[model samples]
Target: MNAEGTSTAGATPATVTTIAGSDSGGGAGIQADLHAFAAHGVHGTSVVTALTAQNTRGVTKAEPAGTAMVAAQLDAVLADFDVRAVKTGMLADLDTLALVAEQARKGRLPNLVVDPVMVTTSGDSLFEGDPKQYLHAFADSPTVITPNVIEAQQLSGTVIRDLADARHAAETIARSGPRAVLVKGGHLGPRSTSDLLYVDGRAFTFAAEHVDTANTHGTGCTLAAAIAANLALGLDLVQAIDHAKRYLTRALKAAAGQRLGSGPGPVLHSVPVHSAPEFATDA
Candidate 1:
């Protein structure tokens, strides 16, 4: 059995596979996801979708992995491991996104958390032109999607400037077919940090007082990955999002005084144990 008290002989560790990019800075993308998975006591695996030369300041360069290679990486993991949940980020091109969406539709994957990472908080564009059409395709298959306000706006073609707009965008995207949408309000305004979850024809808002810090480079990736980790551990969707938001808030607090790069810096993705429940169960 593994440390989480799960059997591992005929089965592997309760694994959450992340199909995303690699951040050389070790702040966001695959690195952040892996860190969050480990911290949450879940096994982590990754298929690199792109490689980025980025620091806290911004992405200076990006080279996307070919569609064939991306597909192969996912196949290798799924064939050998029991991936309970999947989270995706930073697919640098439309073709890569399409490939991912196709595989998921063909039942080659499991519970998916799609983080529609369109543009970096630093104002660097991650996807190329007309990426939304591809995002809509992937969003159509996933169990859940986590999109910040800007990405939500781009995906829904509607400005998500407030909570009402967020609801509208969530409704629009839900029409595209995801089971749930979590529109992150991290970029909404400078006051309260809010995340709106639209599921089962209802909207649930998770709000937190904004933590003022420069070390927030990989927050979005971390949140989605944390939620994926919770799902892998057998939590339901609502419980997973609840735990993820609490975990992220604690991470932001821990990172308040730390510094990673010369630029805006990265969050310290560690939180104390008492801050969250040991595990969540549906029953």
Candidate 2:
């Protein structure tokens, strides 16, 4: 990423870009991702894919940006910033997906994290095209894909009910191209929440005590953006995802009872997640 010490936008090059949609409510999508980046001390940039009239209650309407407009934004960001990592969320349609795939092919967005955003937390479909086709566009090595149970099932064409189901789905998704796959079970009916990490022909389980809170509006986007930020900080894939999960768990726990909206609230990112700050120096 243009040398570690290089300047981009007149800042040190720990910059990350989130190519996703905009939430008027500021709980998910570009807003949440930018907040996650700030937690890790990474500079955040966003290319809004769509705009939504949404709040903690639900999404009333979603409007996608034109292909030409999105392309212009992408061009301007890549030209000016030595972006180290990119996190993709709600890509509206195939054309926008194709534009992002093109940049990845050109080696512009190096450390890519794909959070195949097909549906909103309020149960609304965002992308109208073939889900499989949209997902396969991101099937490339040097990319990490985070798919929840439903999304994993859609990508794998399987029904996921247990850990075995998660394994099969993760493996099938891995075939699509990403070297790493995280099959999240946050939607499972049972008590605890567990995420299956599939990497290098193996699976690792990260189980967290479910906070049982409705303030989980932007959990997925937050996790993906945190991973991207850690990667920009020069962490390995496994390490980055591990740190991100830790941050997400604490963030979720911090916002359990606090209501930021009438409906589901957002994770309180303003709280410090790490016990010891990463860049702290001894005086």
lDDT of 2 by residue, 1-283 (tens): 2232112345564889999999899999999999998877788998999998999998889988978888899899989998989999999889998888888878988789989899875789888788897556876734788988888888899999987889888898888787888887787664647788888898877766678788889899999998898888787776677677778888989899897989988998765545222311111
Candidate 1 local accuracy as lDDT? Answer: 0.82
Candidate 1 off by > 4 Å:
1-12, 273-283
lDDT of 1 by residue, 1-283 (tens): 3433223455656888999999989999999999988777678999999999987788999999999899899989999888888999988888888888898898776888999887899899888758467456775578899999988898788987898899999988888778798899888877757888898788888876678887788999999998888788777788788778888888898888987778766666667423344332221
Our model 1 lands, by Cα RMSD against the true structure, at: 3.6
lDDT of 1 at 130: 81
lDDT (Cα, 0-100) at 175 in candidate 1: 83
Compared with the true structure, model 2 gives a TM-score of 0.91
Judge candidate 2 at residue 169 and give its lDDT: 88
lDDT of each: 0.82, 0.82
